[model samples]
Target: MSFFSRRKLSEQELNNYQQQLNEFKYKITKFEDRLDKLQNDLECKSQGEPLQGVNVINAEEAANRVEKAAQKALPHELKEAFDEINSAVENEQQSVRLFQYELGAYVCANGKPQRKRIYHIDALSKKLKKYGYETKLDSNGPNSFLEVSWKGKETSDISKIDPAKKYVLPLEDTECEITDSATGKAISYEVAYACPRDDKWRIIYDRKICSDAVIVPGKEIIDVPKWVRSIEPIEVDY
Candidate 1:
């Protein structure tokens, strides 16, 4: 290769290495911040001083926003089906439980069978941070999953809001069913949907287990590749 060509290649390689190093540094900084926050929470808890509660918006309000977004995004034909899913979501939100033990606030939401949804707390953390409230997820204890505080004050007082009564839907009944085109075998699937801050719908089909099942999106489930034969929304307690 010519001298100029070799030099150009070397420069490109160096630039790539530098970019990787910068990314590594960014990850390390984030890790350090999480570690420091956890340490601060532990120190405050150890001192036996009263730990402040982390403020969270009403679960009902958060769930309502999600329902409205879903209703708007989904097609008119899906109104009845979507309503069923939305009702289950609202029931779960209304039945959310919060605890003030273990030096932090613990938020809990029961999921289908073995699964327990914790995304709400993560969303709560981001919302609190937007309002200048420093928040950290506390998964240290099985019960508690969030620790909220100010930037300087590790024990700031936060109004504790009780989660609505714990609501859970049985898994024996399936919400939706799909047949694998490849195998022609039909399976019951659990439909889990979420609308994040980005205002986009994230949907998943799982079979009670963590493994994701086959799903093809189209105007109608039957129109998709893996034809969805039938859909039955789980009976949710209002």
Candidate 2:
């Protein structure tokens, strides 16, 4: 190539490098501004010194918000059942025993009928309350159940809201498109649906477990591939 051509190319390259450098500097300034805003918000959230009940944050409220958001995003019947379970919880009592297994027999006298205990429902509210919890909401908003972990000191997954796999085709449909009617958080599914209906389709708008629902992950369960919708997990692996 000619000397002038090479010189012109070098100048263009230099300009491109300077433009990239300016973009990086601009991004750094924007990020620093965001960090400062977040820091100020944190300061506002943790504004008080330690105090008893008077200045305490209610964990129930936080959990309820999470549940409510899920519920409101679900259908009416589902939210109703959810409310029923939440109502059954004894105040300040975290764990609840709802049903007992048939003591799942071994069909042999050698074993003690394998007394397998099944725990669920209101047992959830209290168990979740025990952890060290904090949410960015007003302290005087709503009440919540808080539980401390029996094993670890950290408060991440204190408890699982064990859903009763009811409506096992004995109910209605499994796969559903639900939303929190109250909050509008949405979920679309292609699983089984199990519920009662008058030949009319009920638009699900909240948290309801459609038992035996088929959820295919990383592949298409329906004709049109739906991504971002994680297959509903029947059980979580710790």
Per-prediction tally of clashes: 3, 42
Regions more than 4 Å wrong, model 2? 1-9, 48-238
Q: Model 1, stretches more than 4 Å misplaced? A: 1-9, 52-238
Tens digit per residue, CA lDDT, model 2, 60-95? 544554454333223322233323333443233333
Question: How does each model score on lDDT?
Answer: 0.33, 0.30
**Model 1: per-residue Cα lDDT over 1-238, one tens digit each:** 1111111337754565455545533543344344334445455666765557632334465456554433332222122223333443444421122221323333232211122222334444444344343456665444655444422212212122113321121222224434443454554344443211122222333344322122212212212111011122121223
Instruction: Give the candidate number with the greatest lDDT.
Output: 1
- TM-score of each candidate structure, all chains considered together: 0.19, 0.18
Native-vs-model 2 lDDT? 0.30
Report the Cα RMSD per candidate. Answer: 23.2, 24.7
In candidate 1, which residue pairs clash? 94-164, 95-164, 95-165
TM-score of 2: 0.18
Specify the poorest-scoring 10-residue window by lDDT in model 1: 221-230
